[model samples]
Target chain A: MTKESKKDGGVNPRDEAKERLENFALKVLESVNQIEPPKISIPSRSTSNIVFDEKERYYTISGKTVTRTSANMRQVKKFAQTMCAADFCKDLIESKKTATLREMYYISEGWETGGFADQGRSDRIVEDLESTFGVKREDLGLLPEEDGASIFGDIVIDEGGMEVKATKVGRAGYTIPPTMSDVEFVECGADCVLAVETMGMYHRLIQEEAWKKFDALVVALKGQPARATRRFLKRANKELDLPVYLFTDGDPFGFHIAMVVISGSAQLAYINHELAVPEAQFIGVTASDIENYDLPTDKLRESDVQRLKQLLKDPRYSDDIWQSEIKKMLNLNKKAEQQAFSKYGLEYVVDKYLPEKLT
Target chain B: MTKESKKDGGVNPRDEAKERLENFALKVLESVNQIEPPKISIPSRSTSNIVFDEKERYYTISGKTVTRTSANMRQVKKFAQTMCAADFCKDLIESKKTATLREMYYISEGWETGGFADQGRSDRIVEDLESTFGVKREDLGLLPEEDGASIFGDIVIDEGGMEVKATKVGRAGYTIPPTMSDVEFVECGADCVLAVETMGMYHRLIQEEAWKKFDALVVALKGQPARATRRFLKRANKELDLPVYLFTDGDPFGFHIAMVVISGSAQLAYINHELAVPEAQFIGVTASDIENYDLPTDKLRESDVQRLKQLLKDPRYSDDIWQSEIKKMLNLNKKAEQQAFSKYGLEYVVDKYLPEKLT
Candidate 1:
């Protein structure tokens, strides 16, 4: 859903979009116009190429390789395809039109003719371009659409002449853009952010005026947070320097979603720094919280047991909080979704759970 | 395996192949020359468009609608591509070359430009052309080479000056072409055809001189009978009027293979008359044969159990023999492979099992 822009006075992005495209093209032309063989540098997304920095509390791509003409002809196809996609993506941004990953694939197919076998090759090339530029595809105005997140907060943002007040939208809320670098956050009043896993729980809190009462912004992740939701939450945590907390189902998927938000997803491992909210904490529906709140038991699904068993083996969940909480869940053989808190009464979540957890 | 010529006197097929190619191209040119909208008829392989005839004992394409330039523009593209493929196959035949289904798909993709989505669409169109022409792709000289079935019989045929006598090839046998319309079987001395499911049993019987002793022709199916095996067996049954017996393990896959040979596979359902051996008898290693032969029991694998359970529910397995045999297998939770017959003695299958079962 589109929201009214909060900053009608913000700078127009059309000129900025053109400038970004021109700069990307200039880099390519500069390399091509070189006296020596062109060497393009790119960060490797392969796990072997990523390093965990405990001091910085985040992971970063370590292997920065410069592509040059060598005896190994293996990189020839990849290098040509990456350069082709980069040139194409710049054209997309300059034309002021967004292309889905699928559209970009078809465009590549048309450009390369018989060179491309299928969409998979094109998708990899797009990723190579993203890693090379140190930016997300959405930042280049390419989008898949319909999977961005919903946010209701005391924040103001403008797109073109449209002014959107996130807090005033009430229960409906505003959709976070797939790429928020273009969106200007004119004002920020929320003290913290509560990222809820389910829309049902988010609405209940909204109906109760939980955000206004607790002075926190509420985000409904819908299930596992989409790439846009994670990006938005990461930015909110960093820019406002506000504490971010996650509330999800007391199930394995929920635990993994929370982990993915805090520590980046492996699929998008290359751009982890642009998305992860490392300092974020999960607030509810943790395993122990079920007994403390006397939430009614829902029978554990077969999938829940399987996922819980898996989480126990994962190295990342070796932390004391994750291990103990997961162990408790396994022993209970029951998972409580966030909506289960409604068993304590609709207002109980905002009145009791929030006060107890937050304080 | 190459065999000596049983007959040096046979028709040369280069002229025949050339004639077929000229006729195909002329038909396309005639369509182009037509003053009005030209029409093309194809036997649609869609299950919904198929009609099962119990009386005639075969399935036929129901719709007789010729593809023209009216509303259903769907057939126009398919018709053009199919004609294009037929033209390409003729080119392969005339050029004395062969192409696999994958090669054929790439040829279609190159020829039609944007007509195909994948190999699957191209394959279906090829099948349509095959059904329409009443010929196999290999018969049109588009050979995949390795998937063809091998047969050992007192028969001979000549192709492009190469003469092959099935009996002279000895134990190695002659690989049957996908289609036998051009092949000439010069001799048939055997009383019947023994279609053994495994090469082990076929070899054992051949070594024992069982074919000459019992006045029978032996065919080792290797595993599930390929299209070539099914077609050759069907033609032998129809033309030579030879009694055909199928010998397979008392298991689910074995049963399915027997059924495919008896009532053609759904994949080739359009060409049932050219492949199915409905009158063929199932011989040996049945559920009841365990006690008669004192075969040792082997526990059924999980996949075997699943397949057995599925076979019981199939509408076609409603026959009394199939029901009783499968029911017994499910109840026992055991299966006996055909090799189990060797438990009595090395030649027990030929000496005892065959004598008892055939009698």
Candidate 2:
């Protein structure tokens, strides 16, 4: 709503969402006043367009659809329930409260059915609302579902007209916000954004104050960044023109989580254009890192091997770099998780590993 | 290079593909003569359009593109190789011979370096040729890689100007071909089309002459019907307008095969308009049937249970009928394959089971 009011620092995503919700409601009311059932249209995740952009080197949504209204009763009920969720989210943002999606889904559990059978069904409707508005639920002031990830560096944001120097406060940098857009990205002086897959390695860098030393924004992705985190990083890249680098475990799943941030997951493939960080390049915790750093003994699990075989056949992992890395893992019969870096001692991440891998 | 010449019964799908290939080659030659590298454009299988038709009650493709000459000489080479594949297919059909997709992929193994690294890659490019041309590879005279199912029934086809009644010639029935379009549906006097998911159940019926007894066309899908079989079924339904009943094991994979006939697979989501048969209904070997017939105790496998759990969460299996079936399997801690009906004796399928389930 109203083009994300640009303030002293940066645009506030929460305020923008709240304003859009108001405009959407007003439109619905106008339609109802004329006795027409408001057609609440959201991009259907079920009917998604997943395309690989060769130039940009990421998969993106090139096609999508609004929710169907052919089934009259279902359409009306879906629209009404989405509106209810939207209103609840607005209240959360305004009151400076945050909710996990589970909390929001069951917010009106006993009193009303909301016609949802389980948390899965409820979450889909919520996603419909998010995709419909093209605003993440977290940016609407919903905290992340998982208790993971943190941020550190010279980034300032406008929170309620007050400029917040994120890295200056607290002993270990800033605990990431629910919806990052609630705070404006006022300034990013960091030369680059370094996204890490695990919290252990992330905190090691924060404790070392690596962000300040290396002029980087150190973000622990906590294995697949929540929508808000991805959105924030995407915006930071666009607004600040910062090069982004990623580090994950030398395993299929860890690499998959990294891909989720870089190219977007197939489950939410439609939202990639807005959330994916295309400029991000794989830094390390690579298969080769196991030998180069001489970390620890490793053996790939059955499931790991299964996933590796799939990645071998996957179209997205068709690039030469990905092919070689996967082939290396298959041949070596090993996988290294992020925590394996701990074997090298704490300072190894900040001193030896980070600097060595960055180049 | 003209349209398929409609003969006595129906248009030959193979002849049509051959004509299309000729027309396509001429277009490329014309362009090459004008000094432009010939770009053979096929609807990219990688890029597909899936639309749910309000009127048709199944998904359909509404869009596509020919991944064409935007690239350099490499793209031209790729296009030429794919054209070469199409040419080989055309030759196979004209010679009244057939080859599996695996055979076709390896046809030029020792000769040209089309840059294909594996059968999987070769298969995808060949599939793209199918999707691009809106024709099945089987219709291009290629057979399935696996031998799983069979059918001997009332179906008749126009194979190279000769009419062949599949059920009449043999002691049991006619063996289904790779490309059903190679044979036109001459006469489907059967009251209904009964598609069986497994070979055991199909042969049981054929051996017992169940199709004759019940006035039905019995087909053993052999765990997912080839495109030729699916096309034959689809055409029979449209032209003959026969009610179709699918009988499979009361398990997730069986149901999946049934769905492949009814709605088409996600792998083939793009070509649904030509392939999917919407009116088909699951007739028997249902979860409830086990109880009704008092079939033997067969505990569900871990894999079966896993697939059932996935089916429980699938959007396609969202209907109440599907929900209860999956729930019943979970509740009973048991599953039944189509062969399980043999416990009641082979005649049970033709006599007691078919009559009871059909109603």
Model 1 per-residue lDDT tens digits across residues A1-359: 12232321243434454465467567666767875444466666777777665554556677666553422477666666666666666666665445556445544544553235655777776676667666677766555523456677677765433456665432345655445555665577788889898655665666578888877788888777777687778767776667899988788888988888888766676788878888998887887887887665566788888888888876557689998999999888877767656444446678888888888
lDDT for each residue of candidate 2 in B273-310, tens digit (9 for 90 to 100): 77788888888577887788776545888998888899
Cα deviation of A209 in candidate 2 (Å)?
A: 79
Docking quality (DockQ) for each candidate: 0.01, 0.01
Per-candidate TM vs. native? 0.46, 0.46
Number of clashes recorded per candidate = 8, 5
Candidate 2 deviant stretches above 4 angstroms: A1-359, B1-10, B33-37, B40-44, B47-59, B62-66, B70-74, B93-97, B110-115, B342-346
* Chain A TM-score by candidate, in order: 0.85, 0.83
lDDT of 2 by residue, A66-108 (tens): 6544248767666667777778778877875555554454454
lDDT of each: 0.66, 0.67
TM-score of chain B of 1: 0.83
